[model samples]
Target: MPDTYNITLEISRYDPESHLSWVQTYQVEAGGILRFVDVFRKINDEQDPTLAWASSCEHAQCGSCGIMVNGKPLLACELLVREAVDQFNTHTFRIKPITIAPVLRDLVVDLEKAYDRVHAAKPYLMKPAPAPPEGDEYRISPETLETYVEATQCINCFCCATACISSHHHFLGPNAMMSNIVRLMDPRETEKKERMDLLYGESGVYRCHTARACSFVCPKEIDISHFLALGKEGKF
Candidate 1:
């Protein structure tokens, strides 16, 4: 068996100067275990210095390397070269930036604007439940935390938002909805009613079609659509 395979990447390219977009192709030899980030690095270092993309921590914790591989949202750092080939049954891969936000350049989107909904969700505890006794800290049981812990794993990659069937203009998107749900489930938060109001508001959980595409694309494997379901049913 061969340790390396020649792969072609059809990456989306955007030019801010002319406001044009096109597909740029590059062929590189990749190891089966090499991740897509490594492939991107190889391309940038060897073939094209003009290519641009976003990446912070290469460990998949920062969620900075989010992109669409054959129209599927995924973290480039987590997808192995061979895994992509096997998943699509092709040696050529199409790479595009997530569409939830406007593209700034090649493979880079405006993440600040993309996070607007998440910011609107108010990710912090707005209202406190109550103060703990003097010299004592508030305690939350693991059993209770388990209910919403998965939602907290979201790194704001916006992959779920990109994969959502609902239009971002009308829906809060999965990560934003999950952010509110996490706060609502917390025993330390006393602003449940307000969060619930927002959840059931015009651009809220109701916009979700329960397609579960958000769950399918989440790099963290979080069941984001489940929280949307719970929110729609007023379970939390």
Candidate 2:
């Protein structure tokens, strides 16, 4: 680990009833290997017990530690404090909490709306496969698997949704489009016509204006714009 450096975090605080919001600042010393989650945990333990945040898997698999770092959406668990210092050009870094939506507490934003939007897209396998062919298991070609590989990497973190200005204003979001594309691309799945109907219908894939912000903020680095492009071309 490299030498510890002092950093400052500016968190956005919200109160639901009063519609009041404020920013709270915390100073901490972090090493090169330390992540933003580590800084929050340390602050909660030593400085402010009320400092709130969320995390799971701690390894970036859960996608629970997503937050805004210097105005961009990022996975806190995957972001190193040293990298942040270098980006901001300071031993002391400024961390801004997400403010686009209702803050559940400190770093936590209410994802229920995002989840509802995902469910609205009906992102599920609608296949009617036989009973494993009675003996042999169903197999897929490597090329087919590779086609949907990037779409499958999405962890449903809502970072894409948050970064999508069109979704933020009038549409569902890139996550839903990506999910729909994954299902559409699956070889075993039938019902492409129905899925495409849903995607191009009202409150569907056509709502996306191709802002591409979703792709930029995707923690998994999923190419969301590609899915939108395919959708626009009627290629699923």
Candidate 3:
């Protein structure tokens, strides 16, 4: 095996100065063990210092380093360079900021709008069960919790939203709904009716057309289509 190889990245660049956007390509020398995020860092450090993107906790737990590579939205940190080349059968891959939002610069997208939907949906519990007295604690049986465990795994990366067909429009998007679903799944939550109202409203659950693209790109393997169905059926 060669010690190093070059990979080409076709990145979409937007210039705020002139209000122009274009695709620019860059080549990075990569080793076998590096990840896609590492390639971006190498580009920033060695090739173009002006390049911009967002990332935190590069461990794939923060969900901050989301980008579309080869027309698929997924976490950059979780995808390795070697795997991408092997799976797609090419060392050259096209990358751009996920759609359904405004681009700030290069790979950075404005997430506040999507976050607004999450906040509006009341992502947290309105009526959380109070802690038990003294040494006791509110508890849930494992069996009941198992029903919605996968839904609770959303990292809020907005990958699902980018993949959602209805997201670029008025729809609230899947990950945002997943946030609400997480709270609704809790047996201790008291406000099911209110949650249901928001989820079923216009631009709510029904907006999902069941394309299942969000579930396919989810790094957590969340059953997003099932959640959309459950929400539609008032089963949440």
Candidate 4:
């Protein structure tokens, strides 16, 4: 039989209409490998059907299930029961929504609003360089792709934004800055001047205090601050 743990989850609950909030606790018996998403599912299945949380593509690729586990932003689908218990050295875990956006419900935040800054960065390659003479494949060398490949791995999880101390103070946060940085480093993108303007704008890289919290809690393990630092130096 797999080892089982009796875990206690103190989840933060919020009702937007009443603007009321509270903590609700649930007890669950989970196997060592069971994820926190599975634990939430079990709670909804057997204990509380009214529980509200967002999740899709439970493999940690979608970043839909980003939440705070014991005060740290993390992907719920990636945290295992045994790992949580061992890391915190406790059977009880405190669960809360990521602070990057306004909470809409129990563990659910308004992700669309959170995506505004990222959208402002214009994540696509605007002004592509003439499409490589029309007939030939627009090929990019591996060496060129390597320049900003890691930044492309960002799933827009907002975990980095939540952990960023700079985000709360009119800053565009780490991932949003990385979005612009990736485009800035891409050889195909020709709109460098516009991106530079945005990066140096009021809510841009200048607001970053280099707290490194964004790098610390990123689910993708992206060194987001490093790229932002590069942006600070105009290194692209």
Name the best candidate (by lDDT).
Answer: 4
Q: Where in model 4 is the C-alpha error above 4 Å?
A: none
* Residue-level lDDT tens digits of model 2 in 143-198: 88887878888887777777777776557678887788778888767878878877
TM-score (C-alpha, index-matched) for candidate 2: 0.90
The best-first sequence of candidates by lDDT reads 4, 1, 3, 2
For candidate 2, the lDDT comes to 0.77
Write down the worst ten-residue block by lDDT for model 1: 129-138
Alpha-carbon lDDT, every model: 0.90, 0.77, 0.84, 0.91
Q: CA shift at 123, candidate 2, in angstroms?
A: 2.0
- Score candidate 3 by TM-score against the native: 0.94
TM-scores of the candidates are 0.97, 0.90, 0.94, 0.96
**Clashing residue pairs in candidate 1, if any?**
none
Per-residue error for 140 in candidate 4, Å, reads: 1.9
lDDT of 4 at 178: 92
Ranking of candidates on TM-score, top first: 1, 4, 3, 2
Which of 2 and 3 is ahead in TM-score? 3
Per residue, candidate 4 scores C-alpha lDDT tens digits across 88-207 of 889999999999888999999999998998998899988987766667667779998987898899999999999888797699889998999899999888999999999999989999
Give candidate 4's error at residue 171 in angstroms: 0.6
After superposing candidate 3, which stretches have Cα over 4 Å from the reference? 1-3, 132-135
Deviation from native of the Cα of residue 65 in model 3, angstroms: 0.8
